[model samples]
Target: MATSNSRSCLKYLLHLAHDNLDFRLPEITALLALRGKPFHPCENFREKAPFWCLNDLSEEDVHSIMTRSICAKSAFELWGHGQTHSELKASLLNYPPENMSPFTHKDSTYRINVYTFNKTLEFADRIKRIDALEYLSFEGTVSLKSPQHIFCLLEDYGTDPNNIPEQPNYIYFGRWIADGQRELIRSHSVKNRHFIGNTSMDAGLSFIMANHAKVKENDIVFDPFVGTGSLLVACSHFGAYVCGTDIDYNTIHGKGRSSRKNQTWRGPDENIRANLRQYGTEKMYLDVMVSDASKPVWREAALFDAIITDPPYGIRESTRRTGSNKDITRPPEESHIPVSQAYHLSDIFADLLNFSAHHLVMGGRLVYWLPIYRPEYCDEMVPHHPCLRLISNCEQTLSSHTSRRLITMEKIRGPEEVDRLAHLADLRFSPYQGHNAFREKYFSGLNKREGEDV
Candidate 1:
């Protein structure tokens, strides 16, 4: 029998959700990085595959990841895996008995669960599959209701639902460790939230943004274009002190017409602070104010641990900033009353990146969404800053011709480290200038689609 001390040599398997295929790897990598561990995949690793075998991670590391991951469904300590049943049996036979004995001991209670990916199996077939594992030594009593340990036999039928293989492409057996925080999506759903807006982020994606920002206990998070504080609510749940700034006074105060159906006006307590109170994280609320993100109000210093925001793309909401026309002259004293001007999409991103570079602490992150016109989108279209390093770009398609990329960047150096203006000389930054016309192009696409239909 393999001793418990040898467990560190075992490989772990992460059963990731099939959805959010593009975001899974970055989410997992960020979670692993939170623990100061690098992502180490085993041989034949597939990024889009449902199951991933990770090496050089301990049981504790797996537990930490599962506690925060929304991409992964479950994780397990891999005992053995193979391409076929015969190969699986041979692999299991080769597994050290010393390690298996602790769980399969005479006085232990255990249960085996059968799981198939992209395919369903009948109860009889599931039983037959479990029965095939008889080759392994098991002295434990079978406990269906309550077991001291749970084991799983997972079969991967490949990713394509239209082309599922007749037999599993691979098989794996392992002891279940922990399940991921996928349930947070349902439990924190915006449908039941106290405060919401037309642009309020979905609960699952909000949590994913927080994770990508590496938000943890005692960290400070800020959202510049916080519509209804949806991002703040997610960060507060993770023990981060949350604050935000919105240009709309009505939104910051939550005193305008209600976004809810059948409601004409917002109630007295319909606000971001109340939203935090609803989630039992009111203590993490710092404050929310009506401030222009284009002209940051924070002092000249590293202020926040992370800045996670969703700037308006002029789709559901019109993107505007507090300003008058450059040629217009302001009258005395009346200048206090702010006027509005269209905030071009290109300038929005440029300002956001520049603001994050100044306000975020060293090694802190900035995670935000960048709307894209699929036909004109390219890697260079992403905005860059000298102090920040681009981390990941994951796309979420909104339509046949439109999508949004979640861009994550980390501040590697301070403003003094490099000439911030140097990048402006490069033509790469000019690619995003096309984004200034995004709104016009967006409506044009809709009109073109309508024409095609006619």
Candidate 2:
């Protein structure tokens, strides 16, 4: 029965969704460390899996843990835990946090959780603020770690109160909790960013911040592939000084019908004007540019506190390298560009890791979306980089064209400090490649032909 602070211990069962389970351990560890408390990775790993025991923890603590856990690296989404085992489920419901207190529930602490069950979250009500006694259906209930308190603390440290919302329900709980329902419960900085864009928000980015990047006032956040400036918007909502860049200006600035489209051509100045107005950014222009991510010359050394990005898929619209004098309109005769022919995306990702390591302080993190075709390609690119460690890869469903891979890397003692780097590169890439059921289905239809033959 360990205690975190004034509060005692509480047990939470986090059933992580497949590969995302990898982030659970690191996410919890990061949050605890930020709160002036640190938990051992090996011991805390249990709390991320089948059942996690967070002794003397608050709702904000849990929320941050879930945020980062879902974010990859240090964050992730909650699948149902313990309950997967019927016997465990029966005992867990009775062990809700409300029933116990810091004094009485020392060892057998109460746990609160909101999980994705059959697509929808089971305890969306209990996620934000936890009072062991309040049922999920009630109103005005707050998790012991109130976000308002966290906001106040940020304010005392010179954060903008305008960044903090009036309502609690506006916060995020992934897509499991519907928007309207979330508005009814709590208001969150992450939710504001998710609703601004036309497409579904990048869950990987949301997951990582929820875990690793602690939102202090004026904390600088950057994303090289600032697609619609989603990460910046999210960080700004959370009181961070956000900077982002992209090769395309039209996607950021074009207004009206054209602004709504992606590949249309536009200029950097126009994009900057539209973005500044759209996100209500005033006085200072966003530290954005149309620069290439592979080149580290754009900004000074050790400038950003955090880095997050989603690189382009080679399968889509061709991203021709600049300084070219080739044909103006028709497609290039060659399908593949030589490594020297163009800035290889694999190299961009590896470079992103290296550059972030140089800019980020120790314990800083970088979240990037890696498309998995040949895992070996990614492994080879970042193989022995001392500046970062590949923490986790959360499998996601992006578009029809690309296979989503949410990769989280941390700055651990630089590349020179890395003792060893290994990963379970084994992925069921084809979705149903080696399953027995798939094999049986394909063979069964062909094997049973005319009924009489042997």
Per-candidate TM equals 0.96, 0.53
- With candidate 2 superimposed using the best TM-score fit, by how many Å does residue 425's alpha carbon deviate from the native? 21
Candidate 1 local Cα displacement, residue 128, angstroms? 0.6
Report lDDT (CA) for all predictions.
0.91, 0.44
Q: Candidate 1 regions off by >4 Å? A: 1-8, 326-337, 417-420
The digit string of per-residue lDDT tens for model 2 on 369-427 reads 65543322234433334567666555554323224566667778644323222111323
The regions of model 2 sitting more than 4 angstroms off are 1-28, 39-51, 56-60, 63-216, 255-285, 325-341, 374-384, 397-402, 413-454
Clashes of 1: 4
